[model samples]
Target: MFAVSGGGRGDGSWPGARWREAIALTLETSTIDNTDNLEPTPEPLHAGAPVRPDSPTFAELGVHPDIVRALNEVGIERTFAIQELTLPLALAGEDVIGQARTGTGKTLGFGVPLLQRLRPASADAENASRDVPQALVVVPTRELCVQVTRDLADAGRHLGARVTAIYGGRPYEPQVASLQRGVDIVVGTPGRLLDLAEQRHLVLGRINALVLDEADEMLDLGFLPDVERILRMLPEQRQTMLFSATMPGPIITLSRTFLTQPTHIRAEESDASAIHERTRQFVYRAHALDKVELLAKTLQADQRGLTMIFTRTKRTAQRVADDLADRGFAVGAVHGDLGQGAREQALRAFRSGKVDVLVATDVAARGIDVIDVTHVVNYQCPEDAKTYIHRIGRTGRAGKEGVAVTLVDWDDVPRWKLISDELDLGVDNPVETYSTSEHLFADLGIPAHANGTLPKAARTRVGLDAEHLEDDGRSGRDRRGAPSGRRERSGSSRSGSGRSGSVRSGSGGSSGRGEDSRGGPDVADPATDIAAPRANRPPRQRRRRRAGALVGEPATDERIGSAEAHQSPVPELAGQGETTRRPRRRRRNGGASASSQANQTVDTQDAAAS
Candidate 1:
C-alpha cells in the first residue's frame, strides 16, 4: 500500500468523501423504494399490517404516538433504514427477516412494531398491570438479552410495556416472580427462555409476536436446537421477526422452517459484504507483547472517540481493560468473567462517555449498539471474516466515520490471510508495524512525539471511578463479584433454602479458625449452612493443603473405592475447595491415567481420614 500523505487512507483521502458515499448507499433518495420490491405499498398476507404513506418520523411508520414519544425521550427521533423497511410490515403483523450489519438500528426495526401491536397507546399504553406477556424475544447471549430488553423498554416507556430480560447465570426466582406478576414482553437468551416456558412461568401460547434477534450469533453459539424448540412452543398464528447481521445456510433453513412467507429486508448493507462503508480498515503485523503499546498510542489519536477493543477470550478482555485503565485511559471491560451487573455497568459507562474505551470478548460484544464509537481494535486476530466484520461494525455505525485497526500477531498471519482473501481487504500481509513506527503515526494521524502512555494532563476526568452501576442481583459463583441486581428482593440472600444430608469433608476443607464445612456447630460453616445449589457455591479453600495432606496418607486402593462411593453426589461437596463456576481440571494425559490419578488421591485422602 503506497501512501503520499499522513491521515490518508492509503489514497490521501479521508472518510468525509466516502461518508457521503455511505449516506447515499444507506439513505435512498426515492421515498417509494420498498427494498426487495420497489412498489410504494407492498401487499402483505395480513390486511391489518399496512404500509404507511411517506413521512419522516417513526409516527408516519404506524408506530403509536406514545411509543414515538418514548423514542424521543431516548433522543431517537428519525428512523433508520431497517426501521423504515421493517416497521411498516411488522406493525401490520407481517413476518419479516431483517438482514443488515450491526449498529443499523435493527432493535427499533422490530421493537417499534412489537410495542405498537402489544401495548397500544389508546387506553393501555400508560397502564401498569399486564398479564401473560404478548411478546417474546429470543437472543443469543445474556449481554444481548439485557441490551435488547433495555432498548425495547426504553422505547415502550410511555406505552407501559413491561419488558423483562432473563438469561442463564442468573437466579430463576426474579424471573419466575416477574412472570408470575405478568409482563408485556420478555427478552431472553435461548436457554433461560426455554426453561421458563417449560416451567409454565412464561406462557407462549398467547404470544402474539416472537423475535429471534441476532440469528447468526445464535447459530454460532449452537443454540439453533434451542431456538427451534422455542419456536415450536409459540403460537402458529403469531408474527415472527428474525434479524441477523449475516444470513448463513442454517439461518436460511430456520427461516424456511419457522417463518411463514417472510419477506427479506436488508439495510445499510450489500450482499457482497457486511463491512461498513464509513469505516477505514488497517491491518498490521504487530508484536504480540507490544500490541498493548500500539493500542495506547492509537487511543491518543485525535478524534478517537469511545473506542472498542476486541479480544478472543474472556481472560484477555479483562487483562486488556486493566492494562488500558492503568495507562490512564478511561476503560471498562465486557466478557464472561465479569458479573452481568458489572458488564452492564461497563457498557452503560461507555455509552455515557464516562468511560471512552470498552474492552470485550466476542461473546459479550454481540448486539452492543453503542453510538459514536470511533475505533474498533482487534487485539487478537478474528477467527473468520464474519467475525472481523462484526468487530469493526461496532464503529462506523449509523453512517458515521470510524477507523478499525487490527494488530495481527505473527502466528495469526495465516488466519488473517484467509479473512483478508474472503473480504478482499487487500492486506493479507499487514504492514510490519511497531508502537513507535512512523507508518502507524502517518496512517492514524497520531500527533508527533506521542508515546505509548497518555500525558497526565491528557487523561479524561470522567472514568470508571466516576461512574456507578446498578447491582445485577447476583450471588455466589455466578455473581462474579458484582453487587446484587435486586436488593429489595435480597432481604435474605437465600432464595430457596433447604437442608440436605449433613456434609462431611476431610481436613483439607477446614476453615482457618479450625472449623470444617461439616463440623458440629459452635458456629455453622457458612458454606454448608447456606445449602445452596452446587452451581452457586463460593470459591473453595482446598488446593493450599492438597499435596501436603496426600503425602501423609497410606490407605490401599480398596479403601479408596469405598470412600469414593460414600462421597457426596454433589461435586461441589466432594471438592469444597475449588471455585464452583470454573471447569474441573482434566489431567495432562489420557482418561485412563486421569482415572488412576484420581483413585490415588482418593486412596490417600481415605487413609488420612482413617
Candidate 2:
C-alpha cells in the first residue's frame, strides 16, 4: 500500500496544522506493510472532478457485481471522487485513512468496500456461528448510525447482507434479538456497541473488518477512551479504516497506534478550501431577537425545498422549530435534549417530506445525509470553521446547487470573524441585515410581498405530528395516562398529631391543615361520632412542678379542660377530693429562700382556690 497526498499550500493553514503536518511527515517516511517497493504510487485523485459519463464506474474499480447492481438500482451509476480513490485500496484489505470534507460521499467510499469484503450469511460454513458479525462500523451519533445502516442495507440488499443498527435511545432487547438472529455487518455508536460486547450479547471475535467513521467527532465527545477499549476487544488481525473531516492531535496518535501501515488518502488539494464551491454562502450581522423572523422569511424563499436551521443550543433548536411551526411552516427539531425516539421521529418526518423545515443543533451536522436539502440557515453562529463547514455542507450535496445563510449576533461577531478568517470566507464583517431588508429578498429569491408568517394557502405539507412516533417500549411515562383525581390513604390515621384529620376528594376540598375551601377553620360535626366518648377515653396526665423542681406527682385530667386551668395559681390534684403540695428544695444562690417562696406560692394558691 502507498500514501498519496497532493494539494496546493495556501497562506492560511488548515484548522489542525500541527497534526496534519505530523501525519504528512509520517506518511512520507513510513511504509505501510512494507509494500512501498511493490507498486508505484498512483496519481492523486482531485475532488474537482465530478461524476460524469467518462468517469470510472464501481465495477471498473473491482466492486462486487451484486453491490454494483444494488447501486445501479438506486440510480447511483457513478462514484464520487472520494469513492473512486478509496474503493481500489480498501477492497484489497489495506488499512486506509480517508480525509474528506462532509457531504463528499464518504459513506459509500468505505461502505461499499466493507459490504463487498463481508461473506454472505448463506456462504458461511455450516459449523460457523452466523451470529458473529464479520464487519463492524462505529459511528459517533445515533442518527448517523441509522443513516449508515440504511445505506449499507440498501447497497447490500442484492447480496443478502443483513445490516443491523445497534445504538442507544431505544430498547436493548430489540438489538439483542437482532444480534441473536445473526448479522453480517453491524453499525452502531461506541457506548451501545461496547455495552453489548461486554455483556456478551454482541460477538466481535470474528469481525474481519472495522470502520471508525467520524473519528474526530468521537474525540470531541470524549468517546476516544471507549473507542480504544473497543479496539482492544477486537481481533488484532483485522482491516481497519478511519475516516474524518478533520484530524486532531489525539486522532493522529490513535491512528498511529492502532492502524498498521495505513494509506493516508486526501481527496481534495491541500490548500483547497473545505467549503463546497456549489453552495452560495451569505453572512449577516443581525440582532438575536430578529433571527427567528429572518429565518421565517428565509424559509419562504422561492425554490426552498427541505430547509434546515441550525442553532448552538438544544433549547434554541426547539425554539426555532416551534416558532417556524407557529408561523404555519411544517417544521421539526432534533437535539440532545430530545429522546432518541423523538430525534428519530423528527428526522423521519424531515426525510419523508412531512416537514419541509428541520431545526437542529450541531449533532445533526455530521452524519445526516439528505441530498435534497436546498438551503441551510445558521440561526446561531458556529463555534469554529470546522463546524461552519459541516453545518453548510448539509446542502450542495452530490453536485447540487444550494444556499447557506449565517446570522451572526453582535456577541458572536468576534467568533464569526475567527471562523471566516480560518475558512477564508472573506466576510469578516458581515453586512447588517434584517427580515425586511431588500437585499435579503433579492439574494434568496424571496417574493417582494412575502411576510414573516407563511400564508394559509402555501401551507400544504403535513406537520411533525403527521409522522408516527415508533414505540420503543422504553418510555413508559410518555405512554402513561393522566393521574386519577381521587386520593387514597395508605396507613392508619392519628388524631391531635397535626396530621390530616380526614381524606377529602375532588378540588377545593378541605386541606391537611384543617382549613375549609373558603379559608375558614373546619369544625367537626357534633351529631356524628368522629372520636371516642369521654367516658371510654384514657385519663390524661401532666407532671406538677413547683418553682424549678418537679413534684413527681401526676395531675388530674380535669386540669386540662381549659387553657386557663393550667395558668391558674391553684394546681389541680390527681385524686378525687385531695390537694397535695411537695416540699421545695433549697436554692443554691438566691436572694429569696426556696422554702419561703414555696410557702408563699401555696398561700396564694389557697386564697385563689377559696
Candidate 3:
C-alpha cells in the first residue's frame, strides 16, 4: 500500500482515517453541549501583509508574451501566491498537486500551463492539422466547467485556442457537434464527458495536459469512479495537475495514483489570516416555521444587495422563492427540478440584477462565483464544514466584504454545532431569534421600524419576468420550442389515434412528495416536458390533479344546477349540428347508471301508487 500521509499539518496521521474519525466524533457529540469559543479566530485575507513589489509578473513567471499582454489588458498585473509558486514548475511540464482555499485563483494556476503545452509552434505542422483536443480539464460541476472554459478562452484569445464546456441538463447533440468541429481544450463535468468518450464522440488519446479542478469536491460528490475511468483513458505520459481547497487522504491517494513524481505545493493564506476573514458570520437559533418571516426581515436590511439563500433541498428552494415572490421581492430559484434553460435563466437574472435574490440548493450553487453578493443566508443548516464554507464563500468574493447569516432550527442544532466547531466560528450557543427580535435588527443593521414586508421602493430594478433567456447550450431536438436539424429517435415507431382526452391531472392538484430534489427519472420538469407536444401523446395533464378525480369529484350539493355553479352548458357550434349531452351518473352499480336510476325511480313511484 502507498504510504499514508497527513495534510501539511504534519500530524503524521492517516489523513483519510483522521477525517472520517473527525466526522464520526462530531456527529456523535452533536447531541451533547460542549465548550464554545474554544478556538482563536484567524485574521481576514485583507488584514494580511501586503504583497512585495518584487512579486513575479506573468512575463517573469514563464508565461508567453501574448498571454502576458492579455492579462495586462484585463488589469491582472501580479500573480497570487499559488500562481507565482505553481507557474514556473507547471511551465516545465511537471506533474503538480496544488492546495489552496477557494477563490484563490486555482484555475489560472493549472490553466496557463495546460494551454501553453498545446501551442501549434511546439508541435509538427502535420500533427497540428488534426482537429482534436490536446488538453482536458475536469471539474465537479457544470458551473465550474463553464467558468474554467470562459477564463481559458479569454486568456487564449490571441493564441486561437478553442475551448468547449460539456455537462448534463443539456441535449447531447450540441456537444457532439462541437466535438466533430474539433476543440483544443475540453472542459467538462465527470458524467457527460465520460458519456461522450464512451460513445466515441470525444477522443482523449492525444491529450497532453490533464487538470482535475476541485478534486476534493469531486471526491466528496462520489465522482471518483468516473474520475478513475477517465484517467485510464488518457495517455500515460501526459502532464497532470490536481488542485483542491483541502488535502484530504482520498485526494492524496488519487494524486499518487495519477501523478508521476508530482510536486506538492500548498499556498494558503497566513494562519492568522483566515480565508473568510472578510465575511461577517451570524448564527441564530430559529424556529422552523418562523424562519421564513425571519428571512424576510433580514432581506429588508440596509445595503442587502445581491443576496443568495441556500437551502438543503430543491423543494425548499422553490417554496422559499415562491414565498419571497409572494411578498414582492425580486427572487429566482436554481435547483435540480428546473430545466437547463430555467437554471440558466435564474442565474442570468440574478447576475443582471433583474433578480436580486437567488435561492438555490447546495448542488446547484457549486462553482457559482458571483461578485457583489453582499449577503448569504443559509435557510437550512449545512451538513458539513466544507459545505458551510462553500455556502458562505459565495459572498465576500473579489476582495469585498460580505455577511453570512445562518438560522439553525432546534433539530439542526447539533449539526450547526459540529460546523461551528470545525470552522471555529464562535457561535457556541446562538441567541434565540424571531422575526421581531431586536437582536436581528442590531446584528444585521436593519431599520428599527422595518416590518417583514418588502415595499415597492425596495424592489430591484427588474424581476425575472422582464428577462428573456435564450437556451443555446441545449441541443436542437431538446430545446423545448426551438427547431433542430437532427431529430432523436427515442424508440421504434408507434402510432396513436388522435383523440381529445381529459388531462392526466387537473389544475391545482397535489403531487406525491416521494421524489427528492436531486430529480430521478420519474420526476420530470413539467414546464419542459417535451413529450407534451408530440402529435400522438395525450392532452397535457392539468397542473397536478390526478387523472381519476376528473370525472368523479364530488360537490357539496349533488343536485346543484348550472345557475348554482354560476355557469351554463355549451351551445351548439356552427360547424357541428345540434348535439345535446346528458348528465351522467357519478358511479356504476351502487351509484347506478343514469338509465337504471331513471327506470328504478319510475318503478318505485308505480309501486307506491298501487
List the candidate numbers ranked by TM-score, top first.
2, 3, 1
Local accuracy of candidate 1 as per-residue lDDT tens digits, 136-253? 8898887667667766766677777788888875668878998878788888988888888898888887788999988998999899999999999888999999988777889878
Q: Superposing all C-alpha atoms, what RMSD in Å does each candidate have to the true structure?
A: 17.6, 13.6, 14.8
Candidate 1 lDDT trough over 10 residues, lowest sum = 491-500
**Model 3 lowest lDDT segment of ten:** 24-33
Full-model lDDT for every candidate: 0.66, 0.69, 0.68
Query: Candidate 2 lDDT, tens digit per residue, 1-610?
Result: 2253443322233332212211221111000010001111131112222454665889898889998887776556677667766888899988888876545677788998888887755566741555589999999987778767777777787888888988876668889999998888999999999999999999898888999998988888889999999999999999999998778889978887888767777764232333356789999999888888888898889999988888988667766766676677777777665555455666766767877888888964456666578999999999888788778867765446789999999999999989988877789999999988999998999998888889989988766666555444432222111112222111111221111102221221222333332224555654455685767766876666565555445534444443223332334443423454643344634677555665677788889999
TM per candidate comes to 0.67, 0.72, 0.71
Give the deviation of candidate 2 from the true structure as CA RMSD.
13.6
What is the Å distance of residue 44 in model 3 from its true position? 26
> Considering lDDT, which of the candidate structures 2 and 3 is the better prediction for this target?
2
Best by lDDT: 2
lDDT of 2 at 146: 74
lDDT of 3 by residue, 1-610 (tens): 1122333434443332212111100000000011111111121011112333566888888898877766666556667666777898899988777776656666777878887888583465644665779999999876777767777777787788888888876768778999888789999999989999999899998888999988888988899899999999999999998888787888878876788766666665432134357788899999988999899899888888999999998778877877777777777777665545555666766766777888889987877666678999999999998788778877765556789999999989988888888877778688999998998999999998777678767664467656544343433333322223322211111111000011111110113332322322245666667877767668654331222222222222344332223222433333445643333344457766655665677688789999
